[model samples]
Target: MELPVGGHPADKYQNPKTMKTRVIILLAIFLSAFALLPDRVIKGTVTDGSHTPIAGVNVSIQGGGSGTVTDRAGRFAIRVPNLARALVFKKTGYKSLTMPVTSDSVLNVALTQATLKTEELADQILDHSKQPGQAEKSLAFNRVAAAPATFSGAVMQMQVPTESYKPINENGFLSVGQQPVTTFSVDVDRAAYSNVRRFLNSGQMPPEDAVRIEEMINYFDYNYPQPAGEHPLAITTETTDSPWNPGLKLVHIGLQAKTVSTENLPASNLVFLIDVSGSMSDPNKLPLLKQAFKLLVDQLRAEDKISLVAYAGSAGLVLPPTAGSEKKVIKDALDKLEAGGSTAGGEGIELAYGLAKKHFLPKGNNRVILATDGDFNVGISNESELQKLIEEKRKAGIFLSVMGFGMGNYKDSHVETLADKGNGNYAYIDNIQEARKEFVQEFGGTLFTIAKDVKIQIEFNPAHVQAYRLIGYENRALRNDEFNDDQKDAGDMGSGHTVTAIYEIVPKGVQTSYIGTTEALKYQQNHVRATGDSDEMMTVKVRYKKPDSEKSILFDLPVKAATLAFEKCSENLRFASAVAEFGLLLRGSEYKGKATYADVIQRARAAFGKDEEGYRSEFVQLVKTAQSLDGSQETARK
Candidate 1:
């Protein structure tokens, strides 16, 4: 190098060898700056063995010095140096794949989803595990609540990945004299229970709103008697001292829909409206959904007809009307679904409903089964808009069932609303077992509706009950007059389905601050045939319409005021109360009273009758896990 400059930094190097070293340092610095400017850009989509795009995948150059995450559509763009030799793609619960860099600018790669060994999964779920995080992420899913503040409170909610839940205000006691009539639509959705299990199993407490006490209690089966006559359902009631509050009385009301065997079921005209948006790339979402549909396919008979429609950037029909016997066609259509683009849920609904109408099945089950995380963003994604579309479809005699999958951006409020408006049911699938339960074991109850617009109205006798508070069903409450309105839409009861509701009542003479005294209500007793001297506590009235009927029928049952000790109550009451107590603890309700996780666990285990499929037993285990995570002690009222 020629040193001819004036007083300058580089001019200070006079020795030839030193000058060479200086030149080398300058070259290194120049290369470092150049490294920041990549020489090439590579783009590709990551997918699973089924050729479905995999979202949230980690894409990086070999050795991981630089990386980018795949977007909602499983597509990623990375800038790399010309010398970069290979790309590494990895995701949790999937076999990592590394591919050599080629001259091609676009390279699409597929990964093989790996199944963790049973030992590994079991070790993670059991109490005292060292890696609860790993098990939850690989199995169900792992999501932490959004932080409350940025760079401050535990969770910066606005900045973190978050799940959605409609906030709940716990129901409080109402004086029987002031408000004796309680009316509500029966809810059959079990999403809240499994979703709660997802949270507790991941070594974290579920957010309060996620705990719907009624859903938790209804998740298990109760031995309510089947209808003994021409009616489609039977109603039963029992009262016992509360497990959480001995001073209070727990009233259990159950309605069981008669079971219809598969052979006797009507033909179904099904429309599968799937959300193949990038957000659905999780293994638990799309892959698991495909598997669940296969189970439904396996149960299909010759009379059933099915259609498939999917939405991403836009909506389109993937499969036209085809007989359920053509399994390969449906499975192939499902297999080729690759998640990408924005969600056009509204468009998807319109198209699916159109198809359902085109192949209308009179006297058959016509339903649009919507599977999505409910992260609608593209067009008409608002809850009210979607509800409007479903409402319009409802008029056409098309029902909709919503299947919620995955988390972290899940629109739970939207899912529930769509199902409610469509006059159908909803379920959240956190794992394959739940999928099996929804699509296989409860096949009839999941798809075939036996009764619709089912509503319950109960009138408490002021003489026997001073005050009463209904547990859960806050969202399902209706105006007292809506009970007998045939035009009003309520809830649908599927074949072999059961619904339960609990009430905490304060007896007339015994009271310990549950419901503060009210003077006017005391003097104004419900005097219209109140049965002042009778043993009747409350009268249960049910109104419902046949699945395809336009009119409603009414029936009533009178429940006795006799109360049993918690120990003497039937297994149904004990187990359901245990679940309710657990919900109170999870929700931290003001009315939790003397509730404790320890009591819930003990009560649940004692009432774990037969547990043929081990669901109740699984519930006990989950309670144990929750107790461990909650740091609950053996004592009551933790």
Candidate 2:
């Protein structure tokens, strides 16, 4: 052992107290010197050798776990201990680089591409195929596995929408003899269509929950005969051979709300509840929201009124209840908006509802149009709380319409809950074209409610059908007992909007693993269909309340079991079926029997009647895009 720093070896032996004091002084001096060293932040951009931003690159201090991945912009900032000797940058498909930490804080790194091992390539393929919870171990491996991709030297990190979706449990075959009735709300919201489009356009399969077949089918216009009766909607049914599965029959139900002329529509009272959070700063978010709202503004009549409520870390009334006549003023207020601060969605909701109540308009089109990416971070951020808030406020007679924008960190579940509870409709705007479709082309259907608490119940006859399954609507299913309960809430139907629902039925004696049979009842006898009763396959019952009423009106339609050849079905039904098949394929659903892109394209093309709007053609193109992504060559169009 060496003598204490401040004393000689003889001093320690002669005087222990002097030696101890010298040691304490020396320790203090050493610590003070170390404390004086500068704490530094290393900030820089990571790129490929080609000088393009490389997102998702991992940057770390050597010998430490402290690290961060580059943002979508390929920028990163990390705090390093003063003693850190070097910084390391790494990513897949690129050479890992470690450099000494010099006096400079900014270190721009350009990584070279490198060849990956066979194991690495297999791991990447496996990672892509594994579902969220199923790949925990694989994901853990991937974190430490620095492999190369076939992609270019620099890959821009795409903004991933962290939208939550509950996996859809496809309706199971129910024994008509035991349980004949199936009931669900009539959902007209078209959010799923655009949401699915967003994923496919980005070259990814959509989350299963995002592919609601009914919504995708309803997203397009269907030519159904208008209602001439006292009812506000016309109910039509078409039965045909299942195009995807030869073993089953497809039942299509269509509901078309009565169209009211724009001039005849009621005066409007609107509240634009806009989110201006830091998350909305993306070009596709706040800026796009402004553009969309401007379109709605242009559609407003002189009799209409508008209110603007903006929220960030807090909520504020930006423009209070301005008349539609002052379009310039409303547009100016929207143009001046900027995105910053954390999201306070709950606060914003409360304030928006407060404003709507303060300027309550009876017998007018009173509604609140909420524009957001659904990032409710600051207050009442969870689904249940937001649902309760909307549920309570909906009783105030102001309907809500939710428009979701942007991608990253989107709270889809919260928005869905809010719309469902608030007597509203939800639509996701992925691009300006979708915005135009919602705000301009389908303005009335997007904003004006024609019927509330719309419910559909189907009672299948045991003699005609053995088992049946209602396609999609997993999240919208309601108890059979709740169908007639006027107090029970269901979905709303907007003016001129069309809703479609399909049921796959296994006729009596047909075999299917989708549903199982129960033993004969010992307690009760199965009812035998009398003479002509066997011809009726099912009875469809619809219950709906007028927009402002509490009592619901009931209507029934008897569907004959007669099955049409797939080729003989109406063009509308064929197209809708094609869309449903595509949705199933995207979801990777177990129920997607024989639903090939080729089949869907063929059916859609054949049914692409009167394509003046070019929507059907666009759909064909989208299907091709999805096919290419799925690694299939496009078959020649007939």
Off by over 4 Å in 2: 1-161, 522-526, 531-533, 632-638
User: What is the TM-score (0 to 1) of candidate 2?
Assistant: 0.75
Give a tens-digit lDDT track for model 2, residues 1-638: 57776755655366878878989999999978987787779899987766766655678889985666664356788888777889898765577899899889898888887655545545544654353212322222211122222322222222232556666787777887678789999898888888876665444446666678888888889988888899999999999988888779999999999998887888888999999987788666887798889998999999898999999999999998888889999999999999888889889988998888888888888788899988788987877887877887777788889999866466677788789898999999876667888989998888888999999999888778888888888899999999989989899988898989989898888887777768765543536435235688999999999988899999999999898888998888999999989988877777788899899999999998997656676677567657754542112111
Q: With candidate 2 superimposed using the best TM-score fit, by how many Å does residue 544's alpha carbon deviate from the native?
A: 0.4
- Residue-level lDDT for 267 in candidate 2: 86
lDDT of 1 by residue, 1-638 (tens): 55455744464555788789999999999878877775798999987677756555677899756676664356788887777899998764466799999989998999885544435334334432222111233233332321111111232111113466788988999987788899999999999998887665443557777888888887888899999987898998889887777778899999999999999999999999999987788656777788778888888888999999999999998999888889888889898998877799988998999999999888899999999988888888777888888988887789999999976567788898899999889999876667878998999999999899999999998788888889999899999999978888899899999999999998888867767776664445458345788888899999999877889999999998898877888899899988988888888788999988788889989998877876887686567656654542112122
**Best of the candidates, lDDT:** 1
Model 2 lDDT-worst window of ten: 137-146
